[model samples]
Target: MTPLFIFLVLLTSQVLGGLNNGASSKNVGGRRQPTGGGGLDENIPVIEIRGEGAPMSSAQIRHLEEMDNGGPLDIKIEKTFVPAKCPQQAKRLDFVTFHYKVFTEDNKKVYQTYGTGPVTIQLGTGMIMPGLDKGLKGMCAEELRKVRVPYRMSRKSKSKVWKNIPNDENWLIFNIEMVEIKPYTPEIQFKFLDLNEDEQLTNKEVQDFQKKMKKEFGKTWKNEDIDNVTAAGYYIKYFDVNGDGIVTEVEWLKIMDRDEKLINDKKTKEKGRKRDPGIGWILDFDNDGIVSYKENDEAADRFDAGPTLLPMESKDEL
Candidate 1:
């Protein structure tokens, strides 16, 4: 061919080659292929259940697995499911009080946390399944989300320690609703301090609380070693002003109230409130003199310690 004609032909071939290359490069490796079905978008996942019978056989779970990008966890959120109201945002290390249910692909309910009071879990902690722990991030109080915990993530659930789950179940589907955010408040601290739930915080209770606190929060004045002057002893020595062995509910509240006052004072530092006396303040619940358990429990809900472990119960409670 002539030079000009040859150049024209070469240019056309190069244009067609570039178009083909663009189409090939549109999807690199690791990207998911479209899921196929009628009335269902190819992009959305649909788990087809092939079987011999009716409901049991033809059942299919809408995977909504767009987020399942080969990651250990996959999350599907339904914002419209909940009421218009949504609570504050949840972040890492924040104690979140939430309810959850687990279901098998057959739509059979396996587990639930509703019967027991809402469960509290610290976000980002490995104590929960890896998929769920990560999925719960950025959620707000009352928001609803679905998380699929794969077998790799479900291994922990199969253990004896996680008695709530069925050992045989391979995959776990979670329906999580953020009930409330459990802020580390004085009442919460008090409830944790009142280990026995007797309303009164004894020396033993204080010791246990301090020990747990030291382990979870930070080291004590003496560090790891158990000293003669223990953390509990210091609290008893400081708060048990009358030298009574038992710290009554009134006394418990007194410490908590002091904390509240101190918090308030710090907020308005320049405005200057009266300096709080350590234990000189008054608290007599029964008028008979000592603080009774009944009196102590009157305000227990605000600070009563929740179960550290998952409560074994059904979802109907919520």
Candidate 2:
């Protein structure tokens, strides 16, 4: 080919490639695209293979190419343990539990744990190794994978925990099996009940949500009258301390603090998951302690599960 023609063809191809990359399309989880803000939003999930200190660029991919040799961060899915349709996608702040084992280069087992109860951590929160964080970003619950992390990509600065590992190399090969994906925050149900855009919630709004749930689910879904000493009524009684009917931002945050306490509490109170603060606690009618659920106003205990502000059925993080 003539030099002029070859140059023109190469230039045209580069322009087309740029256009294609910038085209409007929503990724199933998230991906890179331009925005008026001119910065990649970290919350938007990316399918790209990632390294410890940076996004997977040409250099990092080359590093992986030399490290694991090929095959996209060495990911291999385990279909037997996964469901027919894995419902959720692990997101940035979603809490997750997974069983994992680390192996050395010669296939020697280095570290392992969480096979029974599973280790729980919030994704993207530095609770787990960065290599696993990057590799497992959009993975599904109950799915499994084998991933490799080279020394360069495994956060070398914090490399003090290698007593059993060889002194020469500091890499990890993980055999990971995801256990569960749990919600870290509420979604559409919260917005739908907001009634006013004041960024807070009220008892009546929750009651309306209950009515909508019944309409959407069925008559048998919830059964109680508005005026009764409903489970939800008691719940609002705890946080809506002033009894003014509306819950402000500060009050709602208090509920989250209580949840964190209930979750992290190590006492014997862990026998059964206390979905609600419980029955008698709410009757403190004096605004003395904990709270309860989103009732169709039923006999409280029968329907009183714990309180979920702007309550909605749990859903996958898609």
Candidate 3:
């Protein structure tokens, strides 16, 4: 071949090689390979390879296997009825008024809230079983459902066994009907107590609110004729930071924040304090800054009997 012809042949070969290289560079192991710069290509989608890093130790593998086998099972829900006009649904931390009947796997009734009344509980508050709490989510008013609660999701205590509920590993079945859903928060509760839309909570307003809640929840005060002034003063004393008879929204929020901080601090500072004292303080229904022996006893009884889903009660009764 002539020298010019040889040069043309070499140039053609180089051009073909460059095209092949470009095609190969476009893809690597099913992922789009970045080009030119040592930076990810924003236009190309990146693929993630799970378990592609360091090999897990034998102990780690065993622990993961154990978790897979022993972790809580998801609650099974079977909807019985769903209303057409479902404007609202129960969600986490929302107050749900529900009527429930708990039964064993064998269909033996364990507990129920039919004859007495529907009970209200704040979802995700540890007031009910994890299964029940999760099952109640997304429930619209007047909706009926059958929930199967696994044994792992039920309440367990080494020191106490709930009455009628078997301590042995057994699942529960709940037939539930959602009555109402109230969106709840500390601010909402404060607004509820304010009552007058005056941006402040008065002692009388507090008293009236408590009375209204008691009646609404179908609970009676132990002392029917309990002194209203004294009862109201107790809550005012705890919430009213400026020694004023009325509690402003800011003051109420501040007290709540302080209580939360105190609880968190105690939890971090003291490892031995297993139970949150904030809950205990809340049990001081009289708001006297001390949980009385009677209060403790009542709480213990409630625990043994299974909580009634009533979040709060006066020191007098629930």
Q: Best TM-score goes to which candidate?
A: 3
Itemize residue pairs with steric clashes in candidate 1.
none
Put the candidates in TM-score order, highest first: 3, 1, 2
Model 2 spans with C-alpha error above 4 angstroms: 1-82, 114-116, 156-170, 186-318
| Model 2 agreement with the true structure over 1-318: per-residue lDDT tens digits | 111211111223343344356655433234444532344433433243333443445455556566676443433333334556877888776777788787876788877775435566556544445566676777688787777776555542222222233323445677878888885563322343465767767666656644543443221222333333365565565556455766665555555455455545433321221222222223322122222233223334533543333322221210
lDDT of 1 by residue, 1-318 (tens): 112211111223333343344443322123433332232232333333334434421112123232345433344444435546555577665678888888985678987878865666555433455566677777778888887665555544232224576534446778888888765444554554576887776767766654543454322321123342343554454455355667665555565464445445443322211221111111112122233334333323312322122212222321
Better of 2 and 3 by TM-score: 3
| Candidate 1 lDDT score relative to the true structure | 0.49
Q: Evaluate model 2: give its lDDT.
A: 0.50
Q: Model 3 over residues 1-318: C-alpha lDDT tens digits?
A: 111211111223343343345544555446565444334333443344343345666445545645786954567899999999999889876888998888887898888887877877667544556688799999999999999887667664321113444544456898999999998677766665566899987877867865654444322233344444555655566666666577787776776665655555442321221221212233443333344556544543333343222223233231
Report the number of clashing residue pairs per model.
0, 1, 0
lDDT of 3: 0.60
TM-score between model 1 and native: 0.38
How far in Å is the alpha carbon of 115 misplaced in model 2? 5.8
Per-model RMSD to reference = 18.9, 24.7, 20.5
